[model samples]
Target chain A: MIGQGVLNMNTISDKVMFYRGALVPMAATFAYSILVMIYVIIRSSLTIYGSMPKGERSLILWLNGFSVAYSVMIFSLIMAMVSSLVGAVTALILKKVLLHFNPQFQWNKVLIISFTTALALLTIHYLLLRIFLNGYMTFDYPETFLFWWGFPAVIFLGVVVVGSYQFNKALLGQHLKGNSTSN
Target chain B: MKHIKRFVSYTLFFYATTALIYWIFIRPLHLSWGATFKEINKAMPADSLISPNRVVTTRAINIQAPRERAWPWIAQTGQNKGGFNSYHWLENLFGASMVNADSIVRQWQHPVPGDTIYYGKHQGYQTISLVKPNECYSLGGWSFYLHAIDSGNTRLIIRYPSMEVGQSRWTSIYYYGLFEPLHFIMESGMMMGIKHKAERQK
Candidate 1:
């Protein structure tokens, strides 16, 4: 019974690892999408608040600027680190998904997909900044914020692309060896 | 070969389309937001704008002192007051020294319309479009920059365009409310120090 209990614990841990590998990209994508949505809403609200009465408007602008700046810090600095860790861990899980669908299908496609997805996110970030922040033409606040945050966002996207590829390659190379034999 | 070409074409077409759309819509809105923000900021009373525009407080100071006394104080700025002068430090950092680029003396010579000097910074040059010696000092074709209000008793105006990034809002607020007092202390203190030197020499 003690031996059986140890076996069960090992199996459970393996299963957990398997699922974690599969979930990384999806989770990162989900987080990126959610943060973008939040940014969109906040940017819009601040834009509207700027048009109100002078006293009220200034107050709103200050509050919104401070909030948005802080939020970007949380999203980029904190969330990116977490997501990168997730990407680093689950590199092989995507291969399983591909393998299950078609054994011959290459895991390279997952890397391509991740790259395209990261690229799309980056493009969208720029578009949003250009639309809401005015591409550095007018005020110093939004323009300055964009200048500072812009590079980090690019770095994050790059990580997403490269990290996803390495992770997928590593995962497929490792687990798929045994997993493939069984199939 | 045909399939690869088709894929490349599609990717390129999609990228172009999306980029164009983003440029058209997003860029404009961002500009609009900035313009709106500027309007709101400029709407504040001149004085209100002062505290916020500091590091180089452009808000004019109306001094009871004669122009000669004031000029000396202004010229002698950054002499022997702890370390370096506030204006000199500011000028060094932002390069918005009101003085001639060569001269340490930041004086507006009976500045009048058509006699504008460039007050440097990234905000673009401010033309001293108008200057009435000992009476007023205006800049840019529009009436902004330092304006001397009265002769013997002058109102020293420092017209700041807007705040830069990294300049905290709280700093801006603190500047307007407290700067004048600090300025009064520093300038007055410096003046007294200067006066002591002159009087002792006599």
Candidate 2:
């Protein structure tokens, strides 16, 4: 799920901020992917090259490691780009839907809107998988729907709502301190 | 140095959050498909494949093919028969020697309830427990149900209910953390393979 921070865009500057924030998640994903790729290479090397001579093994390991690292880097870049695009679109759709339902923007209403948005995104995801990826939906649709859709929605809303609240508080504190200093 | 620290912190937070969502929410959801509470809880013939104590994971796909067309591909799933329709190279790496059938073999089309479906060399196999021609079948702890959504469409549902006997705490952790995620990759591939094969049948 895209960060709820992305939902606060009101101006071109806010969109720029959203993109800037996106770098955090993208960099995290890239680093994590590289770490996993390295781990996999090491594990596979142990199993496949364990019996080989030390010198030959190290040479093969370095060669294979470099290739895997290269592939991982390329894959991570693609992943970052694709996910950012998806996140942007999801954020836009969510903002639009939230505005439609809760123009006043109560906290409770925001939570509800976030939940609804998440479900909408999940449904679209399921449909896409079915149509394009030949993905299966579970036989027990009700349980699957609740757990799959509900858990992420709750987590996302909690993170966003809380994060935004804390951010606002921090900003307010800074502004108040500035005023005091000026006075 | 401060910027690097912030970057590392941010990266860790992002990674942790994504991982939590995936393990707790996304993985189970994707693995199970859109099964209902009642459908998952209901007893299936495949239940006989294992002792009653187990975790049942069920997934369903709507295929643009009739049940008859889909049945043949599933009926012949084994090492020497029609392959599991997953990653052939990966299977071969694991000593499955899997050669996925491009065309359904006529001889392998008549699997019975007592027959065994070999997964790989060391990978434990599944025993056929139930067979309902063009409708349903159960092998080991997994059951496959083909329901006609319409004249031209079928809902292919696969249920895997495995017993938790002899599993240590570490094994359980490994099962959830690693085995399941890897299993999903192959199983999802198999689901797609079945869909493609059935749809291609004229």
lDDT top scorer? 2
lDDT of 1 by residue, B1-202 (tens): 2443454345345435543543454323322222233333443233332444333223222344455544433332222212122223323223333231222234422333444233333334444444444333334322222223454454343333333436568765444323322233233222223332222331
For all candidates in order, the CA lDDT equals 0.39, 0.61
Task: Note the clash tally of each candidate.
Answer: 23, 13
Task: Tell me the deviation in Å of residue A118 in model 1.
Answer: 1.8
Evaluate candidate 1 and give its CAPRI docking class based on DockQ.
incorrect
Q: For candidate 2, lDDT tens digit of each residue in B158-197?
A: 8876437568987776666555555654565576678778
lDDT for B13 (candidate 2): 68
TM-score of chain A of 1: 0.36
Q: After TM-score superposition, what is the CA distance of residue B88 in candidate 2 from its true location, in Å? A: 2.2
TM-score of candidate 2 versus the correct structure, residues matched by position: 0.49
